[model samples]
Target: MYGRILKVYPGSLAEELELVPGDKLLEINGTRLRDIIDVSFAFADEEIEMLVEHEDGQQEVYEFDKDYDEELGVE
Candidate 1:
């Protein structure tokens, strides 16, 4: 199971990672996501390891080192 990305805000971390709508978010920091609530909790960390499945069916992992208060800007 995965969370589908709907939008990536410009000038945000999602955009910086090149994520787009239709991308499937699989996990954050190795924890599987079951709902939006999980996403919220998982995103609180300064270090993130995200696994995403692109529209092309290719899966990739993205790592980010950010401010503890930074947002990813995806909906």
Candidate 2:
């Protein structure tokens, strides 16, 4: 599950999630993400796992657990 961060809205949902522009999404709950549709569907769950790649070539994994309908605060 991988997609590049195309854009981020100022003071929007994505900003609160720390999803910065130029970051590359690598996976969701250990599952590979193919596109925007996959990311939308995968984030529907209460718990999610993600892999993010920074422009410096550093990769980090994150786990987020929240209310099912909680907005991801993403762009």
Each model's total of backbone clashes: 0, 6
Question: What TM-score does structure 1 among the candidates reach?
Answer: 0.95
Error of 2 at 38 (Å): 1.1
What's the CA error at residue 55 for candidate 2, in Å?
1.0
Give per-residue CA lDDT, model 2, range 1-75, as digits (tens): 468887877775457667888888888787788888888888888887878898889998878686777665554
RMSD of 2: 2.1
lDDT of 1: 0.93
Overall lDDT per candidate, in order of appearance: 0.93, 0.78
Clashing pairs in 1: none
In the range 8-37, model 1's lDDT, one tens digit per residue, is 999999999999999999999999999998
lDDT of 2 at 63: 81
Off by over 4 Å in 1: none
Candidates in order, TM-scores: namely 0.95, 0.78
